[model samples]
Target: MIRSTLFFALALTSFSALSQSTLQDSTHIDLQPVSVKVYFAPQSLMSITSSTQVVGPKTLTAQGSQTLVSALNTVPGIRMEERSPGSYRLAMRGSLIRSPFGIRNTKIYVDDFALTDAGGNTYLNLLDPLGIQSIHVLKGPDGSLFGANSGGVIRIQPKGFDALENQVQLQVTGGSYGLFQEQLSVQRKVSDRYQFSFDHSFLRSDGYRENTALNKKTLQTSHQWQVSKIQQLRLFALYTDLKYNTPGGLTLSQYEANPRAARPAAGKIPGAAEQQAGIYNKTLFGGLSNALQLTESLSHHIALYGSYTDFKNPFITNFEKRIERNLGVRTYFSYAKPEAAMPWQMQLGYEGALGWNKIDNYDNLAGVAGKQQAMDNLDNRQWNLFYRAQVELLKNWNLEGSLGLNKNSIHYKQRFPEVNNPTGDIKFDAVWMPRMATSYQLNRLMALRASIAKGYSAPTLAEVRSSNRSINTDLAAERGTNYEIGYKFKTANNRFIADLAAYTYTMKDGIVRALDENGAEFFSNAGEMKQRGLELGTWLTLLEPRNFGFVRELTVQAALAYNHYRFGDYRVANKDYSKNKITAVPDWVNTNVVHLEFPQKLTLHLFHNYTSSLPLDDGNTVFAKKYNVLQAKLNWNTTLTKNTAINLFFGADNIFNEKYSLGNDINAFGGRYFNAAPMRNYYAGVRFDLK
Candidate 1:
């Protein structure tokens, strides 16, 4: 695999070199300045003193539209994995030790709404790729403004805010393994003050392995209205019905025998196929945001949102049902004095959430719910107050600082033959998080930055009440501090762009996952961890765009992440595993992308990923092998009429047919850790746009 990856890298380098020579006299790449909103305000990328990456439409379209795993992996310091067709897991600047299924320890936002609930869980899989316009990733802990999170933050911008034209679009797609998808979208502008967009999509697939099928439907809409010259209102809504099968993990011997087979019956336990092991989720979410400019230099913004979810899971061990509801509000005030001798800005904000969860667990009798085993009702509340300020001095130096105070508590009542009828509220002590950063513009093409921040994350509801059917009141929250330095550079002609960053994070009382003899999972606090890493990104434009030339444009981009993570002061049950490598964290990862545009409006996109091996257990007794994956796509776009356009695209994934496990079950009791990913697959699609 390493040899193959090296050869592929060298080939691409040679091709890029040839193209650069051939187009030596062509105009330099005409790149544009980029901006981000991680600070609740727009800031130039070149001047921000933080590690951030942005992904736009071109990056999303380079791969298949089925999932965001491949596209998101192209960014350094990020890892996205899929266990099956619809199950996803995300990690940034940290190991995936605490999360076995969903997203945790990270904050996420869509438009003006917080997707991460009060329980610290995000349903990222329920979102359709077509509904997303762009993504901005903030690496490392940023709890000063975004609340409790130790991993990172992801902000998603929905589709409607990108344009203001009235239009209609339809798309149809089909692929191997009985995959089918359809999407429809419409946007209308009633007047200059109001506009709205609506989108609907359906997707289904017969997965590569048995008992791994998927079906999903989505509906989404967004509206923007300028009520007055100094006021604006925005509303967003989304609904998704998603269902997917879960193929249980396999032992080494079972995996070697037949990688495509689902987990078979072990001893007297039932198999996944017989028990109908899968997930069924139905959710509805809506939010309204208002912005009012009270004075020339003062403004206020507020958002109100609510969501409900009906979730069900039938596994070999038990059948679980949950009814969850969440409500939240976010409001902030800002003051700016840019025209003063010394420009400055200040913002103050508050975010809070209230959540209720009713959970029931029952025996699984041939895909049916049987005798109740456990039941619990939990009420959770969390809130954060934050303040940020920025100042400019000496015409080239910028200084910034922020702080947040957070508090969380949960109360629960147990039913169904419960020993404890009611449990007192478990309250976590208030914590303070602070951040300081500085940036200096050395020249027109170079910048230098440094920052230090603190992060804190409380235990989620899932961790508090795990599958072991016990409430672990002793579980402690994790805390960490990160120090980072970065540099940014670009050429005068905008043909080359490069960014480099290095950081070290020290965390105490880190949460880790464990399993019982029956395969039920639990969580506990470990001793400590020391994580150090470096990230690099480079983009070069070989050929500029020209309508009269045969070769319209060509560009190549590469990103790399290197990690040296290790356990410190760690000891568990007579085991002294200190100084061992962290579990499920690779030593290095690299991704590359190439885009070429030809005459006749034809384009080709190529993607490659190489990941190094990593340990699967805390003791470093088992390891997963390294692997490489390659994908490609070809698209042809043309104008069918003066008011209409058509686009046709075909793509293939895993072009080399590498056998690997996308998501591994950590610390399994019986060495059932391997979940095989799909082999080579192909897909084709057509789209039409009407204006």
Candidate 2:
């Protein structure tokens, strides 16, 4: 399999080289400056002091990524995994020890509106890749500005409503494992001051493992109105209906024997196939945002958002149902002066969220609800106030600082099997976080930076009221401090760029997940843990457009990360795990991408990824094997006429056919840790645009 994959890659490279040799030269295309808005204020990527990455439409289209994991896997100090279709978890400069199913300890936002609930859970899978125009990722703890996150922040920006002309587009894709997708989009310029855009997508797949199937539909719309010369109003809405089956994890022996088999029946518990374990979700979300230019050098912005969700899950032991509602508001004020000798900027903001949930549990009898077991009502609230300032200390030096105050609380009331202490509440104390950073530009091509920051993260509601039907009143919030230094460099012509960073953090009261005999999950606070790592990223332009025959452009990008994480002081069941390697955190990760572009808008991409083996459990008694994967993509775009265009794309993943676990069940019972990823897959798609 490895040999075949290598041969295929070589053939593609050779073919592209031959074509380049026979073609004529074209005009050179200069790289544009990339800007991001999530960093307190809009700034170029190279000017940020923190370790950050930005992905725009060009990169997204080149990769032909179907999920967020594929789009972000090449980023340094970050890892995204999919245990099964519609199930994902993300880890940034840390380990996934606390996240068993969804994203945790991370803050997510969409154009100044919060995507994370008050309970600190983010449903990132609900958004379709086509609807997003760009994504910004801030690596490491950033609680000082984003609030209540130890794994950093992610801000997604959707396609804008403004359009130079009215247009419509349609796209269709199909691939292995019965994969199919369809998308439709429309943009309209209703008037000089009003514009809107709408998008809808449908996707389905018959997965590789038994009981693993996915079906999802998404609808999104955005509208913008220029209320006045100095004011603007924007509205955003989204709806999603998603359903997917869970194949469950398999033991190593079971995986070797039949990787496609579902989890077998255990004693009295039913098998995954019999129970039809899966999740069903229907959600509606909307937001209203406004920007007002209060004065020549001052601005004000505010946003109001709300969401409703109906969710259900049927598992081997039980069936669960939840109805949730969330409401939030965010407001900010900013002042800036760029023309003065000592230019400065200041921003102050407040964000708050309220959530209410009604949960019910019942016995699962062959994929059906049998007898009622428990019911509860949960209320959660969180608020944060933040202030940030940036000033120019000298012609080539800058100083930035931020501070935030956060408060979170939760209340629970039991309705079924009522007993003593049926109602309880937990309120965490208000926490303060502060950050200070400095950047020194030695020259136009290089910069040096350093920072120190504090971080805090509260336990999610799911961790307090666990799947085992137990309330963990002893759980506490996690707190830590991080220190870092970084260096950035870019060539004069922007032909080469490099970023390097190193950091270390020590955290107390670290949350960890555990499973019981029946496969029910729960959480507990570990004593302490420490993490240290180095991250490096570089991009080199090997061939310039007009200077290299038919090759419009050729670039190579690479990222490498090294992590050393361990338990400082921890014990489970009277056994000390201190000095043990952190669970599910690879010691080293490397990713490389090769991009080639030719005349007539033809593009080709090759990707290679490697991950080192690491421990799978707290005790370090089990480990997952390391693996490498190679992928390739090709795309061609053409203009049929002045008002029509077409694009075609084809891609293949895991071309080596290596059998590896995309996501592992950490600290699983009965050694059921392996969930095999797809071996080899291929996809092709075409799109049409009309104006």
Candidate 3:
């Protein structure tokens, strides 16, 4: 399969080159670079001092619309995994070590609102891929601006906010494993001062593994009104109902025997299928943002957001239910002096959040809630005061500095068993995080940058109140410092672009995951971790749009990441694991993609991924094998009329059918680590658009 795919790719490249040579005199197709708002300000890629990457709409649509896993993995230094149809795990650098299922240690924002709750957990799975317009990833840690985080930061931009014309779109899709999806979107601009958009999506699938099924529905709306010449108001709301079966992880022997089998009964324990292990999450989120231009050089922006979640899980050992509510506010003020001899800008901001959760655990009797086991109520509050300043000191030199003071505390009360019913509160001392960066423009097409930042992450509510039903007040937060240098280059014609970055991060009191005898999970602080890595990305536009040839456009993009992650002075129980390889982090990861556009409004996309083997346990006794994957997609677009259009697409994933685990349960109690991914699958879809 690899040989055939590579041969086909080569043949297409040769054809594209020949076709491009014939149309050398054709009209030039300008490929414009996009600006990013990662730092609360718009700037070109090369002008930023941090290591960041932006995934645009074209890249997001290149893969299937069912999930963002494949598209996000294309970015260097980032990894996204899907254990099932609707379950997602994400990592920046090597942060996946602490995440067993959902997203943690990372701060996430949807537009100007904080998507991450006060408990330091993000429900990334609740957002549908059809509603996402783009994703911006800040690779390392930058707590100086966003807040407390040791892993990194992610900013998600929803669709319809950029629509300037009235439009309606409808799409339907069907795929292997009984997969089906439908989506609808409507956008309208009422005069020149107001605009609104609505999007809805539904997806379902009978997954490949036994007892693994998924169903999800999502609704999102965005509205913007220019209240006056100096003020604007924006409103956003989202609702999602997501449910997916958890097949549970398999032991190596069990995985080898039957990769498609759900966890089987061991001893007196029930199997996943028998227990009907699964997750049900229903969430509603809303936010209101206001931007004001008080003066020519001063502006103010503020956002208030709230969310409610009803979460349920039925597992082999227990049934868990949670009712969670969260409220937050983010506000900032900016002042710029662009016309001054030495241009400079500054921002002052504050972010605060409050969350309340009521958790209940009961015995799982054949997928039903039985006798009550444990119950707890938790309240969490966090706040950050941050300031950032930017200055153009010299002709082509830029300097930036930022600082943030953060405070976190949690109050918990147990209400179930008398022995565990302890009323207590944990308050962390306030910490100061600072960052400094500098960038120099060597020329119009080349730039050099360097930065140093501090990182700190408090324990999440789940980690504090673990599956053991005990409050771990002694668990300390993770702290780290990162130093980085980067270089970027792009051709004047925008035909070639490349970014290279290297960083060394040293973290102490690192949090690690462990499982109890019952296969329940918990967290603890380890000694320290030392991580060093290099990332490189390049893009080449071989041919642009042409009117006369079969090959209208051709582009090639590739990303590579190399990691050297190791434990420092780490000892657990009777084992001294100093200098051991970090669990769940590979040494080498790479992705290559090819895109080709042809006549008849047809397009083809090919993707390949390679990941090296890595340790599965801190002791370095077990390892997950290396793997490669291949995927492809084809699309045909045509105009039906002056105000209407249609698009048809077909796609396939895991074309090589390689056996691998998309997510691994590291440091599992019984070595039940492997979560087998699906084999080859195919999907087809059609979309209709009215303008």
Among all candidates shown, the one with the greatest lDDT = 3
Error of 1 at 400 (Å): 0.3
To one decimal, what is the Cα RMSD in angstroms of model 1 from the true structure?
Answer: 2.1
- Please identify model 2 stretches exceeding 4 Å from their true place: 1-32, 161-166, 190-192, 547-550
lDDT digits (tens) for residues 1-691 of candidate 3: 3543453355446445644554344444423345678887787787889878888778888988889988898889988888888989988876577774478778999999899998988999988877887888888888888888877888988875655558898999999999999999888898678998889999999998988899999999988998899998989999999999999889999999999998888898889999999999999999999999999999999999999999999988999999999999999999999888889999999999999999999999988999999999999999999999999998688999999999999999988876846898999989999999999999989999999999899999989987776679999988889999999987666666778999999999988988876778888998799999999887777777776688888877777889999999999889998999988899988888888999999999998888888888999999988888889999999999999999999999999898998788889878898989899999999999999
Quote the lDDT for 62 in model 2. 60
Cα lDDT tens digits for candidate 2, 1-691: 3432453354345434533453333333333245566765777666677888876666666665457776677688888887777788888888888784478878888887899988787888888888887778888788878889987888888765434358888889989888899988888888889988888999898888888899999999988899999999999999999999999888999999999888988887788999999989899988999999999889999999999989888988999898989999999899999877898999899999999988889999888888989888899999999999998889878899999999999999989977664888889999999999988888888989889989899999889887887767899999999999999987666666778999998989999887777778899999898999999877666566653458877876677889999999998788999999989899988777778988878889988778888788999999998888888888899999999999899999898898998688888988988898888999999999999
Candidate 3 accuracy as TM-score:
0.96
Clashes of 2: 0
- Winner on lDDT between 1 and 2 is 1
- The lDDT values for all models are 0.86, 0.83, 0.87
Please write out the lDDT profile of model 1 over residues 290-396, one tens digit for every residue. 99999989999999998999999888889989999999998999999888898899999999999999999999886789999999888899999999999988577
In candidate 1, stretches whose alpha carbon ends up further than 4 angstroms from where it belongs are 1-33, 548-550
Provide the lowest-lDDT 10-residue window in model 2.
23-32
Ranking by lDDT: 3, 1, 2
